[model samples]
Target: MQEHIRQLFSENIQTMIAAGESLSGPLENAAFVIVNNLVSGGKVICVGEGATSALASHFCQLLLDQFETERPCLPALALCNQNNSLQHSHQQDYLARQIKALGQSQDVLLVVSSSGSEPSLIKAVEAALTNDMKIIALTVDGSGELSGLLNQQDVELKVPAHRRARIFECYTFLLHTLCELIDMTLFPQQGDL
Candidate 1:
């Protein structure tokens, strides 16, 4: 059992290393977009489905609270925390409505989907586009529908793996990296301590 567990950890680490090599540029660009939006007094809206919902909420929490060092609270919201009625709504139109109502041209919309084919997430992306918000998608390879939807203006950090669990694990690291980058950019004096 211990050997199996060790193998799993080793495989996951290898996947993460491969993801880092391929996604570093896109991740950095996404961080820049997020930092620039916040610096300009814009907000960040995060949305996701299933396990990714937790990640979306965590991203918002880290930004609204703090990731590492002391700094002013950044504006961020996670759509996954919507009321139960919205969560249970038919076809998740409520989420799309919320985005349409709250999203602004200057805001950034961060969407996470391992499969990159959740209908609700796609709707949220459409609403964000209608509102002229920038989009940053964290998804895995072979994300056909989601990849097709992204335009030149959008940033897609498509991890090189196909398994959902592996993609999500990579996302966890990417989120931490994003927070660190934001802190470093905003507070260079902190020195990443």
Candidate 2:
């Protein structure tokens, strides 16, 4: 079992390393946008559905908490927080409303949607766009309908994995890598490894 586990980890790491090279440039650009926006007093908002919500929360927390980055505690919110007092439809409405309430024009919205086509997801994306917020999407190659909404030049990062579990695993790996890269870029001796 341990050997099998090690193998799994090794394979995953290799896949992520490949994905990293393909995505590094865009991820850096996204991080730059995020850092600049925060410096200008804007918040970072993350939105997703189902498991991607978990990813969003994890990414948001990591960005806000990692000490090496030395970044201020910028306002970061996960729209999928169950405790957020909004119904599904209301939450959809609130995404745009919340952005307007909390986000500045240059603020960043990192939207992680493997499928990307969920109504709530679409609603949130629309809201982000309407608010003139910069967006960074971490998604899958043929994530079907969801892929359609994403603009290739819009800080979009896509993994080649097609299966949901594969996509989810790769998504988390890529996001963590981006965060690590950002931290390294911002603070050269941050011990990112």
Candidate 3:
């Protein structure tokens, strides 16, 4: 049991280290994308597949409540929150509907998913594009069709792992890193925090 647990820890650490270099440029770019939208008075719209939506909500909470700072709340919301999904998951267009209703051309859609293959997620990406919104997708390295759908304006923090658990773990870490970068960039007193 101990060795098994240690191996799991090792795998996660290794994945994060490998991702350090690969994801830096894209992640930094994503931070600027988000910062640009925010400073422009546009909000962030977060969505995801299955349980990943919880991560979306958590991110919104972090942004809205405060990400290790006392600065003003950043505008953000989760289109795929538990209640919204429960009320509308029956329709494939659920997320798209919300995006069309609330999304603005200046908004950034932060899409979180382990596998980027869900039909609904694909539809969500298409909807965001139609709205002229930028996208920041946090997904596994080889995440399928959803990645293909992203245009040059979009940023993808592709996790450098094949295992779903590892990818999800990386998402959490990456999200934290992203939040820190945004906070430090937007609020410069962070001093290498």
Candidate 4:
């Protein structure tokens, strides 16, 4: 049983390492964007579709509670929460409304999707653009409607894994690495205790 648990952790670590290799550059860049916006008084808004939405909310909680510096928590908000079912019904419009209501020019939107082609996810991307928020997209490399959303200026991070679960796992790895790096960089004196 212990060996099985160890093996499971080993595989997970391997996946995370591979994901880090695939995502390091964009992850670093995204971290810079997130930290910069946060330092400048802009909130970080993260959105994800389906299962990824849960991941998004989790990321928000982690960022709010664990990742910070002199900038404080920087207002991590999730769009698709249970309390906002009325807004969630409209999908894109809900995202647009939220962006308009909560986002500022300095804000950043972190979009997480496995396929990245889902209408609702695309709509959220468009909504973020409409609100002039910088976007950090985490998606598979091979496909997606979000290709149009990626540009020279935006921080677009891709994971090599194509499977839905694998893609989201990679996303989680990226977010965890981001949180760790941000925590250390932003609060260096704490060290790696």
Candidate 5:
């Protein structure tokens, strides 16, 4: 039992290490996209399902509230709900519909998924594309459908691990790192705040 617990932690740490090596450049690019969007009077829309949904809400709250220091709230929305009826509606495009209604050109769309194959998330990507928004996809792998939809303008932060737990763990770390980078970039003089 103790060895099993240790293995889980070890695996998570390994995954994070690998991600840190590969994702640094992409994450920086993502932060640049998000910060540029906010500076240009655009907002960020995040969408995910299941456990990823909760992470989406958390990310939005982090942006709308605070990450470390006190600063002006940023515009971020989470199209997340655990309720399958709303998330996986008959059309399986509920997030896409929401994006179409609220998303605008220059906005940032942050899509979180364990696998990039989720139909609803793919639709959301399509809507974001239609709206001319930038995309930052957080997924375990880029070999799925969502990867194909991303263009040169979009950023893909793929976790190095395939295990759900490890991927989710890396995601949380990645999101927090992004928040920190954004704060530092946007509030260079306000770090003590």
Candidate 6:
């Protein structure tokens, strides 16, 4: 059992390394766009489903609280963090409506999904487009509905993996990287060693 655990750790490390190499460019672009949006007085709105919902909330928390350094709070919101009184169908429409209501042209809609086919996420993306908000998608590789929805101006960070667990892991790492980049860009004194 110990050997198996060690192997799993090793494999995850390898995946992280590969993901860093392949995704660095896209991640940089995402960070740049996110920083521009925030500086322009726009908030980041996150939406995801299932396991990715946790990631969406985590990303917002990191931004609204702090990633590593002490700085002024950044504006962010998790679409999934809503009242439970709404019906299931209402909940599905809640995110779209929220984006349409709160989103601005300078704001960014960050969507996370391992399969890239969640209906609610798709709706959020469409609503963002309708509102003329920028989109940053984190999804697994391969052509899917979510991928198809992205336009040339949008940024899509596609993890080059198939397994859901691995994809989620990569997404978490990417989120952390984004937080770090945001912090570094905003507070240059807190540079990583």
The deviation in Å at residue 179 for candidate 2 is 1.5
Model 3 RMSD in Å is: 2.1
For residue 62, model 4's alpha carbon misses the true position, in angstroms, by 0.9
Alpha-carbon shift of residue 120 in model 2 (angstroms): 0.7
Which residue pairs in candidate 5 have backbone atoms (N, alpha carbon, C) closer than 3 angstroms, thus clashing?
none
Q: Write the per-residue lDDT of candidate 1 for residues 98-172, one digit (tens) a residue.
A: 899999989999998878778888888888889999999998888858777887878998888876677888899
> How high is the lDDT of residue 4 in model 5?
96
Tell me the number of clashing residue pairs for each predicted model: 0, 0, 0, 0, 0, 0
After TM-score superposition, the amount by which residue 101's alpha carbon in candidate 2 deviates from its true location, in angstroms, is: 3.1
Candidates' lDDT values, in order? 0.85, 0.73, 0.87, 0.76, 0.89, 0.88
Instruction: Report the C-alpha lDDT of model 2 over 1-193, residue by residue, as the tens digit.
Output: 9998998787777767777788878777877777677667777788777788889999888777873456545467776534466666675555556666766577788889877667667766666777778788887776656556655435878786666766788888777876776666666676455
**lDDT string, candidate 4, 78-183, tens digits:** 8873344565566456666677788788989888877878777787778778878899887777756886786665788777765565567677777887787776
Tens digits of per-residue lDDT, candidate 3, 40-125, equal 99999999878888788888888998788777789999886334435554577778878989999999999997788977788888
Every model's TM-score: 0.93, 0.79, 0.93, 0.82, 0.93, 0.93
Clashing pairs for predicted structure model 3, backbone only: none
Q: Tell me how candidate 2 scores on lDDT.
A: 0.73
For residue 12, model 4's alpha carbon misses the true position, in angstroms, by: 5.2
What RMSD, rounded to one decimal, does every model reach? 1.8, 3.2, 2.1, 3.3, 2.1, 1.6
- Candidate 1 vs candidate 4, TM-score winner: 1
Q: What lDDT score goes with residue 193 in model 4?
A: 45
Which 10-residue span in candidate 1 carries the lowest summed lDDT? 81-90
* lDDT minimum window of 10 residues, candidate 2: 67-76
lDDT-based ranking:
5, 6, 3, 1, 4, 2
Across 58-158, the per-residue lDDT of candidate 5 in tens digits comes to 99999999998989999999995334665334457778888999999979999998888888899999999999999999987654999899999999998
